[model samples]
Target: MEMVAAAATKDAKRNGGTPEWRVTVPEGASVTVEHERCLAARAWGWLVSCVVALGAKVSGSGKRLWKIGADDPRRAVHGLKVGLALSLVSVFYYTRPLYEGVGGNAMWAIMTVVVVFEYTVGGCVYKGFNRAAATVSAGAIALGVHWVAVHAGGELEPFIRSGSVFLLASIATFSRFIPTVKARFDYGVTIFILTYSLVAVSGYRVEALLVMAQSRVCTIAIGIFMCLAVCVLVCPVWAGQELHRLTARNMDKLAGAVEACVKDYFADQPADGKQPPSDKAEGYKCVLNSKASEDSQANLARWEPAHGRFGFRHPYEQYKSVGAAMRHCAYCVEALSGCARSEIQAPHHIKQRLAGGCASVAARCALALREASSSVAAMKTSWALDLAVAEMNTAVQELQSDLRSLPSKLVEEESPAAVLDAVQLFTVTSLLIEVSTRIESVVDAVDTLASLAGFRSSDVEKDEASETETKVKQPAASDPDSYEPEKKHIEQV
Candidate 1:
């Protein structure tokens, strides 16, 4: 067997693309081939892992595709609008007269529709107007530069051209750093730089400069106007509407994550003594990721007009505070999650008492967030928000009280393990208090948002009617066996 193994190694090294692997065994009778992890075995493991990763990738992509398809059944409306706009522009160049009349620059028009077009009509409107403004302003400046360079002539012309490029590039680069301009006029800034560079380098003669600039601007404007028309006139997709919806969805995800975290903190172990991935822990990141979407959409939404009768100027100021509140909520969740993750040995009795109160408070907190999401979605502020917040405040206070009231016997134990458990419990309780405060901020922010969006008492009442039906289908909050069961136990603490 040793001779055969030696021969196998020699043959493998002679024929191999990969470096040689030689097996060595103990000089005893314990040799077993079954334990060997040879090339075939390693290859099989690599193949399995690759297959698993690919399957997950494909599955995730499919689910995302389905959502995109189902979420907007009328997406084809935007597609039709795009196609129609493109075809109309195509007809201009297709004809002899109109193409010449429009300066014979079909690429400019076609590219404008393609670049200015977006999934949302408001996005197109915002980008198109910005692009045209940038182009015109850049064109005007370029023509001026051309005039100066032409009149200067010879050696001076090259120097002047270089100076103009450097000046414009430096100024534009610096201006893009400012927050407001960066948000709304970022695309414009980029286009301005591109246009200015081209004009400076193109070396247009004095006589042809104006004509060239005019043709470029005209073609771009036609494209912009065409795109704007199609977007507004043909099944417009409003960015503001989508922004509001996205914010609500984000709130809902946060609520779900809160619920999952609370459940996992006190969840029972598997029967086999192994722990599966906790649903709540998995949800923690979802709350964090929602922040980016909220920010992007809100900025874009501000550029949009007051559509769907939500009123003008849209109180974007409120989102800034709400985001602060949401971030606070996220930090509290992280702290609480950290506590649950650490292994702290506590007496079973103490564990039971702490968990019961903690669960009650957390569950109510989750409900409050879920309600907040629903209120924002319907554009109806909840009357119960104040009450729910009060409940959380009270529950958190009582939980603290209960923690303070942990049996006197625990004090006598004086064990380091008991001390760690007590410390962990306090840490988690403090996080809950912070969570309650942040939830209040969220509730207040949403109320202000609803009011700004033109919500009234009547709107709340109308929305509540539908929500009441939804609530009735589920168990009552006051039901004894429900998740909201008898806060009475914690109340007495």
Candidate 2:
């Protein structure tokens, strides 16, 4: 068998193929062969596993992408709008007459579209305006400097050009550090620096500087027009609308968090030793993280023109105040959440005493927040909001009274362990009161926003008032006896 195996190996090697070994056992026994085929099988298995893993990864990425588009179809529309803008701008390069007009600078239009087209109309307009202004202003300055440098003689021309570039660039860079400039004009400053540096440096080697600057500015203007047209005319996403919706949504989330926290704190624990789900209790965390989004939306909203229910000078800044108030309330809600989850719980009897009052305050506050959200979303003030807020204030007063009565009860308990529980309960009650206070601030901010934005009075309020008046008059109309005295008195007068 050894000689046969050695011969087979030699034959396989001589044939320039993988070597195979053959082993012979006793005549009746089953024969088995181990060869490179096993290695090949292992390699195939590894390759299959790699392919499966790669497929899974690709599938996961595809699902996430799909989810993004599904979550907001605006993303897909924005993408199409971008494509349309780019296509329109590309006409400058594709059409012969337009190509002759801009010459070789047509690429600037394409580049401008890519850079300026944004998710929202206000954002696109903001960037487009900045780019156009920066390009033109920077070009004019660069041309003036170039003209001066050329007449200064060759020796001093380099110094003049380089010095102007350095001085202007430094000033522009420094201006970006200012809060107002950074908030409103940071992009403009950046573009100014880039355009000025490019035109100034290139001016040294390129003659006909005026024509070059003109062509670049014209192409950029063309691109800006295309972007503005596409963004505004087709499925525009208004930054003001986004800010309004976000502010309202945050209020709703805060309301849910407040109600959830109070209810969870006073809830009876399950006998199965399972913890309750905390998804609603944690809703306020989103409100806490929304400061940056609110600020960005407000800033961009300022650039938007009057559209839909918004005016030319909508109170974008007031949204920030609303966000601030919500965040304050959210912080208190977070504390309430912590108290709910704390191990040092108030005695069941004590909790029972305060539960109704706490729940009433929470429910009233939540209702007021929801009403406020509805008012903001509808761009109208509602009687419902006023009523809800008034109820919340009443509930808060009642809760305060209930809290005042708790001290005597706690003193009666007087146990050391019970003291800790009372302290925890006090912390929760204090946070609840603070949260209610902050909610009032939020409501006030929304009211201020409504007034500043010129929000109309809701028809629902008017209809209800009219209905009440009709009911009051109908009784007099139907009951002739009630109207007879007034008619006789008027006749005598």
Candidate 3:
């Protein structure tokens, strides 16, 4: 085997390919890889080849070939071949010529097809034939309950036996849960079937017992092997892959929302001194959209990407974490939008009165303008918004981490409060971060406008000085005569 492998490696290298393939026996190992893996390799390879050949002959006729028991058809075929061999042996030893025309023929035919189909598609191979066994077990229980009620001379007492039958059925149905409790739950299903069959055949005569027991065992056992063979033959599609894709898609959407926020904040706009009427509205709308978009992503994460056979039992925790992050992003948008909108327009009179240094352009053109002092006020508002936006972003990242931890940390018996606490922390953290960033942006915009208008914090000092000088020059008119004359003169005029 080593020589053959070496020769193959040389041929592969000669054909302009790297020697990527090799065969080796591990140290202290009694079994060879060839013995353990040979059946699988041969079966899968042959099946693929057969399918290709069949497709070539049929010209697209085999596009939607029937999928047998999560297994490749070839594996299922192998199982059927084995089953047929066993059936022939059993028939030869267990049957008489006189009884051949009775129920045996029909039972074998039905059992064969069912067993083959179940094994091929039900994922019975990788795990065990639990589902098939569970169903059969439930059926057997129902039959037993019926028999017990009849034997008790309470044939009309369907109610008495109904409880046991239904309970067994429910147990069988939920046997999927047993896999969680114990990795090998298939044995439970088998035991359940056997027990139920034993109960149902308890009062039956020998002939009836033989027929029913033989049929039930044959169907269940055959089904189990057939499903295993089927799964082995197929490529074994993973449920986890679909879950991951869904998780990624949701995360991408969340990322897109963040990108949109960046673009909206940094995008260039008309540089005219006059603020556009729609500017505030557009900014606010973008903030709202960002919030909603983030929320959706978070929801997608929590629900997980549901697909495949085992998805119901699989908890997708990562998706939930992404969602928490998105919420933080939304909170940040809110803070930013709120700060941007809180800015008060400066009074036009202030612009008109301070004509030379601050409001000169507005006064000259008779244009609407903000009060000079209001510019400084707006700056402070923007600063607050910016701070909030920054905080919200930080919170989102934190919350995402917390959410990611949930799937691994959460236990079946854990208190709901624990989960809620984690979620709330992430949410609150994101909200604070968002609020900080938004405040910062608003502050920045306000400050820029203030600077552009020559309304700096230092300007307040200048205004105070000018006010002092004017007060010193002004004097109170203490003369009543002067005031009386001014009033009389105004009246006469």
Candidate 4:
């Protein structure tokens, strides 16, 4: 076949194209080069399909194999890598003359590859190391127990060997409940049970117990190595990087939510606007939904090794505090929404002032949130977050003063319905103060995250001049709407 191909290539070069093909017949067996090449290609194609099928089945990707689209590329890459790794291990075993029968039944190695391969490289590495450690520890223990049972004499040997399985099972089961073991070596217990059963129970029948044990361990190790190599070396997907981006996206969503909520909250306050109560509460959903996304990515990021600039799972740990801050912000929004639900009539002149103040503060807070989001996305310090915190504090103080200047007490001695308007105004003031206070922590949370992600002070550093700048931006104290536009409108005895 090689000679025929070479001769055909030479003819094609000389004549500018291939001459008419002729097949040399072997009497009754008409075997042609073309037929041989076609058969070879078909066999190769069939082998690939079979391997892919087996790999998909083993790695649990069989169910998702047909989900081929933008969302399914990760699975496809994982399955392809798994199939390739399995084939490589098989090749090493089959081609080596000395491996002959030793490599023929390397199911242990195959199983290791199948079980350790995960979507993320970090997950694969973690599982691979855990599996290898468990297999070795369990195999060693099994071999030791088998030796002890063997020397226990002919009469008691069977009993001791049988009891060893139960004993090992009990220990393995109990050890798995330990916090440290459950956290790190949970899989090891399962491995201990299987390894011990195989070595102790099957050792009696199989005289080559030691050889079987050695082969099993070797195959498992090979499988783990192959899986780790492919998962790490081939276009690896990182959980930490994904988490960072997800958090940033969520922050952006939160900004939009706040912007919308504030716009609705203050709309048409005897001014020019028309928004429903439901519209005011819509922003809270984004903040609430953000919690779930933040949680999932944080958990996955924990499994990821120290990635990029993050130190050994540092980025994952910060999520707890950051998530807490976000939850607090969500609660504030909920409270504000509650206030928005109640219709509150205040002095007509002061209504515009209150609404304007809240709208301005909300806009500032949203801007800060957006800046924090960008800082997290960029993995740098955000002085803008700190600036937002100060603005919220100032707003809270202003709201408190406004609350104190209101006429009739919200906790009225008069008819409850008579002071309903005062109570509503009080509720709005209190909710606004709470929202401002809660928003103050968001910048700190984001800043802490930035530091943990390894962004230094020099990188997007903050300035103390923001306080002076914020004061400058504050509404003048003598303005008609300043502090108490309704001071003269207060109903007195």
Candidate 5:
């Protein structure tokens, strides 16, 4: 009798329909009613038939697969077919009692068919069972409360109040235990809550209520399993993997852009103080803008999945860094353009041009054009740009070293310092130092930009500028035009 009562209690929590308990309550000798009113036999039967009919109607209709003009139409059709089949099977099992006895071999066959279908379709065997477990637990708890109320001669209102409080508390308490049930059984928590909510509102015998709940739960499990089975047996879609691939592809494109920008910088005369036309700087600016824009998009695309799937914070710093680096490159290109124009327009009488000097400048400018246009087309190629930038910095340092080896006068003449007064020279030198500081800062920014685009930096360091001055070769010392005729005449050859 105790075992029978316990089984009845368990069945009630499941929202089982029409349970027959041996022990009768004081208020009622026996009770028979549907458990889950929402999906009782009448409603379940219609819903199942409707789903099957819909599936049959659209069996080979390509429209079902390509609901939207997206990829993989077959997967959708497969899901529909499996879902329809599962629904039909579930309806058959639930409605079996209409034609046959409830506790007979027919009910057992229905349960077996439903469970087998669920396991085969669904990937996670244990998680699939949580829904059923929750319904059963809820129904059992509700039934126990009702039995106690009737046995103690309590009113329906008190019974409901007690049942609601217990169900809510049970869900909360059992949530801790659900995690331990299986790795994928996290959804079990929701199943019980939903089942209890439905049962409490419907006044019925525990057995009847559990039967209805079980039927509903079986149907749900079938649907879920069908979807899973179709996806696994056919070509499954993985959002995480797709998102990751998209991010990687965009990064590659951005890397290409970076390479193009870097190569262009080196080839462009304006960037490194060589010159061609006045419009070159403007052209370079446009290229930089386009590449920067592309890189921005790629960077955002990389973060989309991270933020969407895992709730990671959006990378605003990367966007700002790329923007700032592009701007700095623009400024450098403009400055180089101005220097190149100065070299070109200088009076030929003042100094003879060195062999191939003009051609070298032109070649540099041409290289920049080609790189910006072809080799490095996207910011994704940041690694190549980083290498180029490092090379440029090295070349600049070498040039500075060569300039220092000459006399102090030569240093003043070679740099912008030649035109400045003593105070101005000091000020200009300080300004140059400040500018150099900015140059290094821009280099670091470039490195960071490359890193964000998934590139590594080489082990090259820009040694700090020395405070001590080096000797320089003065141009005036060797200039025939600047020689005093009397002094040279006295020392006649």
Candidate 6:
């Protein structure tokens, strides 16, 4: 190998090129080949691993999607409904007759379906109506502007058209900032601006502006109609029902959080003396984040027509009131939860001393909340709601009395740490009291909703009425004098 290398170097110098050295490794030849083979094997292994990992990720994603569809079959149904609507609208492009009817503007109908179709019927109706009305109004204004600009001749025509677009667009955009308009007709205003701008700008060059506007409006109307039909006729999810159900569910969750916070605060510590694992219930947390959902649902619900158990003019606004009250109570609950998990915990005996009163207040409050929830869910006035609120108030008073007597106990404690713990205990108690008080607001809101919505009397009221009637008809059989009076009264009637 040395001799061959020296010869190659001399040959490269004579040729005026780079040196090239070659060696024969007869003994290590198989090992060198084996090393190369090992590297190749590793590369192949890595490639296989990467492919396997990708396949696994894809499979997992697919399973998650399948699980989501399975969990709420309604989502799957909604997807199918959208596909069906699009397919039905697509016929305008596929069939010659339909194509001739709307011309190439049939694309507008497809676009409308894509943009307007929603999971809930109310949402679809809301967007569809806004789009259709905006298109027609904008188109009419556009055509009139175009006609005037054309008659004004070439030089002044451009200014007239530009000025109209700027004025109308600015007015429409400014209207969107208003509260009422922003809430309900914001989408309409946006559509109006888009339609007006498109038509107005295009009219500068297009000769047949009227025919184009007409075709587009007709196509959009067809799209809107298809969306409404599918949304209403198929598995329609009513926004009102969703809002109603969501409000009731939040009340139930609030009740659970109140009761759980009180119970957890008074619960016994483990023997090991370590703080128990934090088991914060998510129920009240959900209430804390529910404001936006409530607002959107209420807004969408207003667009919904009269449906099962809901009147055409049902007081959907009242639901927001109920939600506001709930969120307030939920804030207090969240504070109590933090107090429960605070580093300075009240002494066990102090907790014991206040436990009964606090538990009673919490229980009564939870009971009242549950009654209100049941009222909303059943769409009926709760017969026992007033009684429940009264009991809750009484419990609150008792808790207050207990709190008034707590200072003496705290004063007796010699250790400052013990006093601090008592202060924490008082904080928790005060929050509970505040929560109990706010629960009344929640109940009142529900009562107002029940009255405005014209909810029927609950089953409990009917049962009580039937019981009273039976008692009245039975007469006083044990007392002959009362029986004769009752019999005489009945005969007279």
Indicate the TM-score of model 3: 0.30
Query: By descending TM-score, how would the candidates be arranged?
Result: 2, 6, 1, 4, 5, 3
| lDDT (Cα, tens digit) per residue for candidate 3, span 1-493 | 7787888888888988766565666754645655668878999999999999987978654443444434455555655655554554345236676235344533543353343332223223323344455546555555656556666775544455555646664766577566443434544565565456444445243336545555555544544554445444544333344333433343233333333333322223334423333342233233334434443333232322334322443433333343344344445544433322323322223212221211121121111111211333332222333343344445445545654555346444455555543443334334434433433333344345444433335456667899999977765477466477679989999
| Candidate 6 structure quality by residue, lDDT tens digits, 1-493 | 6789789989899879788776666868889999999999999999999999999999999999999999979999999999999999999989999999999999999999999999988789889989988999999999999989999999999899899989998899999999999989989999999999999999998888888998999899999999999999999999899899999998988888888888877888656544442443447988889889888888898888888888889999999999999999999998877766555677798788789999999999999999999999998886699899999999999889989877766667554455666777788889999998899999989999998999988776789999999998975768687677678999999
Instruction: Candidate 1: list runs displaced more than 4 Å.
Output: 1-68, 71-81, 153-155, 203-206, 271-281, 343-348, 407-409, 412-422, 458-493
Instruction: Score residue 241 of candidate 1 by CA lDDT.
Output: 76
On the 0 to 100 scale, the lDDT of residue 199 in model 6 is: 97
Itemize residue pairs with steric clashes in candidate 6: none
**Full candidate order by lDDT, most accurate first:** 6, 2, 1, 4, 5, 3
lDDT of each: 0.75, 0.88, 0.43, 0.69, 0.44, 0.88
Which wins on TM-score, candidate 2 or candidate 3?
2
lDDT of 1 at 392: 81
Off by over 4 Å in 4: 1-76, 90-102, 266-307, 312-315, 334-353, 407-419, 422-429, 458-493
- Candidates 4 and 6, the one with greater TM-score: 6
Instruction: TM-score each candidate.
Output: 0.74, 0.86, 0.30, 0.66, 0.34, 0.85
Alpha-carbon runs more than 4 Å astray in model 6: 1-31, 270-280, 410-418, 459-493
Where model 3 places Cα greater than 4 Å from the true spot, the runs are 1-130, 143-147, 154-210, 264-493
Instruction: Please provide, for model 5 over 1-493, each residue's C-alpha lDDT reduced to its tens digit, 9 standing for 90 to 100.
Output: 7888888888877876656567556543233333445458768899999999899878756665565435756455645655654555455446756324333223432443343332122322333456557656877876665556556664565666456767696755576675444334455666566566666656343446556655555555454455445444555343323323433333233323323333333333453454444333344355345544444343333322232232344343444454454455445444444433443333222122121222232333333322322221232333444444454445445434533443355345565443232332222222222333343454465345444545322222111122122223333566776567867897996
Cα deviation in Å at residue 223, candidate 6? Answer: 0.4
Backbone collision count in every prediction?
Answer: 0, 0, 52, 0, 51, 0
Q: Which is better, 1 or 5, measured by lDDT?
A: 1
Per-residue accuracy of model 2 over 1-493 as CA lDDT, tens digit each:
6789789989899989778777667653332334456778899999999999999999999999999999999999998998998888888999999999998999999999999999998899889988988998999999999999999989998999899989999999999999999988899999999999999999999998899999999999999999999999998999999989998898888889999999998898566533364788888999999999989988998898888888887889999999998998898898898778766576767677788988999999899999999999988997889899889889889889988877776678665465556676777777888888888899999999999988888876688899999887776556778788799999999
TM match of model 6 to true structure = 0.85
